[model samples]
Target: MATVLPEGTANNTAERTFDSLNPATDEVVGTYPITTPAEVDAAVARAHDAARFWDELGFAGRAQRLRKWKSIITRRLPELCALVRAETGKPEGDAQLEIVLAIEHIEWAAKHAKKILGPQRRSPGLLLANNAASVEYHPLGVVGAIGPWNYPVYTPLGSITYALAAGNAVVFKPSEHTPGVGKWLVDTFAEAVPEQPVLQLITGFGETGAALAASDVDKIAFTGSAATGKKVMATAAQRLTPVVIEGGGKDAVLVDADADLDAAADATVWGACANAGQTCAGVERAYVHEKVYDDFVAKVVEKVGTVRGGSDMDAQYGPMTMRSQIDVIRRHVEDALERGGKAVYGGLDSIGERTVQPIVLVDVPEDAAAVREETFGPTVTIAKVRDMDEAVARANASTYGLGSAVFTRGKGVDIARRLRTGATSINAPLSFAGIASLPFGGHGDSGFGRIHGPEGLREFARPKAIARQRFSPPLSLTSFSRTKATEKLVARMMRVLHGRSR
Candidate 1:
């Protein structure tokens, strides 16, 4: 694959370089610099300075620039999608879907940020009605975003676009395995606004990410495994720099007895296997009502059989993006079978050279890793539950509450609301991700903070409240000339307005 980075970023020494390999073919995709600490700091320093200019542009100017950037990505989507497929081993169609959603978010942020973060008048309450109060969200200066390999473009852009719309420069640290995709985005951003380095890329390993986490940036946004997120938070804590952590999740799908079994099964398979199941909100476990568990399992098995994984266009999915994750997938599947679970579909032998055939385990122990932890592979565990209540209970039992889905003819929304996840969809598969107007994030081990919609605009900004005196009050509460009689009058007024009835 061709390099996406600018000229100066290429490394000259082998030790200082890291190669991104096509997971399906195990071929070198491209090599990127193992950005040093100094390089990371320099990039942040540049973004820090650029933030002043970006912030000065105000919402209107920044939104226009962001829209330009969004247009460029939309126009060159084919090229971007191909690069995503090359680096992440995802199919071009899947890659396109991700970029398409990302572009939509950029558009939404550009169009709505000004309205969402602009100054708004507010009541000063009964005690201060004479004063005029208003509040506006100000940019938090430079923002450092560490991206994940899965859905790299779309996921990172969730924060990057909102930050830019809120008028903050961004220093992005793309996953080392997908640096080229990151570079493409930053380079295209530079094209939109040629005069400024508002968005910069620093491609490297964990050390580079660590430096950025502790840099002078006003805030950090990280998306990755829960363990790494903790380390990032710790590093940022040294300077009391705030962070938005989008951590890992072991999401589940709850199927109700009254639900449409065929639709539910189809959605479940897609949610479990799409993008090789590396999605943070991907469904790794399914809880089906006992009345329809057998039928649902049959549909899932039939649908799964139609899907295959490879580097070819005919394949439904691609290989695991991270080579090491192959073992994790194997371990989870094997452990499930060893712990008395029966494979309703693909089994241990389904694991191949670089691809893992869709594996569906039924009756897997509730405590099994296949059901408890994030497998991050094209595998899922199906269990029969007594009722919707049982399904909800089991789903909520997970410690990672990132995303969830419920399939029910009647109680879909009710069950979805009961789910302890950050985002839950009713009778649909990961629908929340496609909606740009909704905020996305997780709770507990899934991490905190939102990225999208009104909440997202404020996430990258600090609200500044202003209270201006409109007219002089009858009594000068702040003046020493205030008489005891006036103070007593004020006390009487307070008692009348807020005192409890006797």
Candidate 2:
């Protein structure tokens, strides 16, 4: 199996590793390897060696092992949740919530892998009447995944579980900000299946991730900024490795005229503020119908003000996981205010070095920085639209097409369908991410390829199609034993079949 001796284990090279610090507290949590391209190559070679053994185990065997891993995770939920909280500085409840969703995905991937990816019969087309056809999804050997810090457990596990279920060995590079969370995960996997290192962990900064990207992995699954996603793609391009790039987004929420204002407000506040507004699919902008704009904004502010950010147990949320992001959040807020925006709730004063209270801006311009750029913080910009059509047009104006939401009474589902995004929640916000069976991903600047559901399983596996001649046909088009008479007959048959349509 593929394995890397974690830091302080066998390869105690202190100079080559870095500290994993709590961005919220500025305290060192753990130290991990700064993996070089050479190390990445070694890891991928190990994973390649393990992949054959894993594939030979077949679907039933793999599913059993995956279920075992899931059991281990569920049994030790509290410990893992605490580790996540410490590394990411999220509230305990929020950490548990994300881990619970990750567990669901693992369960779903285990139970559905065989049925979704195993060989099945395919229809023989008219041109090959005597041929029997089938297709089976085969594992793509070793996969490399570079994960993000936001929702560390959930985001990375979405790739890791689906890859494992599809019978591929994985070499995971967890974010520098959340190495402890990554260590806990990999250690548990090793414990669950000690005989085979089907899952492995490597830790470091951007250079380590870039090294993995350029390594000889069968496929790359990355969840990070679009800028880094492009770099990953470029590095993988050297080896012609396929990749699934799930990048950032500037998602929006549309509030229709007849929508339930209270529900919309509640969903928006929770979606934008949950995880300290560090969510990739979080609602950063909202377009409300003019008829109910006043009431909707009022409710959003009222609910958001009640939420608090702190490190204690009673707080609703916690500090920002990355201190640098605090400045990014502040820049967007400050720019909006300078461009004639009004702060209905929290503003520049709410942004602290460690934590940021949720900020709500009103009447921000369409071209303003806050509205155009991705502000991955607990912030939202509200604008009044003439109608639902205008709301959707304004929402789709950006270069992002990740996750979106629509709040409406009778036209909720219809409006959601109209939005040009990968996932949409009608009358709810970021709810699609929780459904394990629904494929989660985005398009345009949000990046392509899915990380959940059957699509996700197939992302790490390649389809192998088979065709066999079941029986002999009287008219054999594929045989070279045909004379001019047979050729004439075939032409006549083709004419009969398709001449009228043409």
Candidate 3:
């Protein structure tokens, strides 16, 4: 039987209840507080009230407190990882790695927020020469985030940390499957800053998330399916609220003929099987050079066969966190086989109730759903291409352009640049996610906006431009006293500067 928590409570009272189950055993882990529309409104109101104090604290004071929060999280890393592992049913080591990355982002954002967000002088155009100008980033009063179940800690923290450091109060609504992890993060923030509620949590089902989207928050940061993102944006449009979406991806990895097969195989195995292949940036498709295709597929299949998925201590993969996802994984596999794709390793029988064994496919059609759509499972489709150009072309054919990787000897960086994705790894798989200095986001259907580095800090804050008159210009165009000669001079200057004939 499933456990059910109360629908309404002092911490978070609402009119709905949802169950969070342990995927490994198909048992109820715990029930979370389901927030109603009224509760979501109250949370947003409190965040707005708290943001006034938080925004006034200035970047230095905010950084100091954020540093304290980082320390608390770093010291309790093991404890936090345990919660992550239990809630998401992922390996403990994987959980630790994710937490460490989250810490790195938090530390980076805290240290760099002042420099990236502080006011800086701007050069007013020559047309407005008499004016002194400056631009500064201002916080968007309250930020709402709706996170996913995969990599629950790192994914949400990407937005939560940056928004907080940018001087905005955050009202986060984590996936219902991982509410405990969300509660722990919010509680930790409370420990760091007891004076005000800089971060708050509102838990519930889709209705609750919908309420958050409709609430009066200045911005919404969402990470989930593209379909859901569209709905969130549509709802937010009701209030003319802005949004930053980090949606799904059918990412690819390209292997050149001159690439190291060993490294490519290892990356393909880990990328497709880790977290039971529930990663947004996981390798769902691979376009390898025809000359090296056979060798690469053999090695990847051998490595994948040795891996296991269960609650066992030695298991490399874990059960699917969301039970409903099992059907989706199964459907993709069946569809692939039905469309004349050959599975080199596991077949349709590999998908279980909670755990999905690794499936490696070769000779799959590019148009097959398994290859074209976002499987988001531990299944990868490998195709043979003529050369690097074909590999790049096939990789770029996908609708989702989140992250892609290339394994080669000489032209890895150059090829990475050619791929039309947000971030690219030269010889590594998903290393861009760990580098706090590099911006992390995507373009096209993968989504817009950024979540890491300087771009991320700016995303959370709006630009405030100030211009003051310092001295009278040679020709004052703003007033009616401007002469025709001055206008003629302006036209000549424009022609000389911008309209010059090539």
Better of 2 and 3 by TM-score: 2
Cα lDDT of candidate 2 equals 0.87
lDDT per residue (tens digit) for residues 5-123 in model 1: 11123345857987777877767888887877888889888888899899898888988898898899999999999999998889999999999999999999999988999999999
The lDDT leader among the candidates is 1
Task: For each candidate, give its TM-score against the true structure.
Answer: 0.96, 0.96, 0.95
What is the per-residue lDDT of model 3 for residues 20-101, given as tens digits with 9 covering 90 to 100? 6667875666677778789999999999999999999998899999989999999999899888888889999999999999
Candidate 1 regions with alpha-carbon error over 4 angstroms? 1-15, 500-502
Q: How far is candidate 3 from the true structure (C-alpha RMSD, Å)?
A: 3.6
Question: Relative to the true structure, how large is the alpha-carbon lDDT of every model?
Answer: 0.89, 0.87, 0.88
RMSD of each: 3.6, 3.4, 3.6
Name model 2 segments beyond 4 Å from true. 1-14
Worst 10 residues of 3 by lDDT: 1-10
Steric clash count of candidate 3: 0
Kindly list the per-residue Cα lDDT of model 2 for residues 1-502, writing each as its tens digit.
1121122222346577677777667677777777777887888888898888788888888888888888999999999888888888888888889999998998899899999999999998887878999999999999998888888999999999999999999999988788888888989888876777778888776667777887889999998887778778888888899989888889999998889999999999998888888999999999999999999999999999898887777777788888878889988999999999999998999998799988999989999889998899999999999999999999999888899999988998888888889999998878899999999888888899998998999988999999999888777677788678878988998899888954
TM-score of 1: 0.96
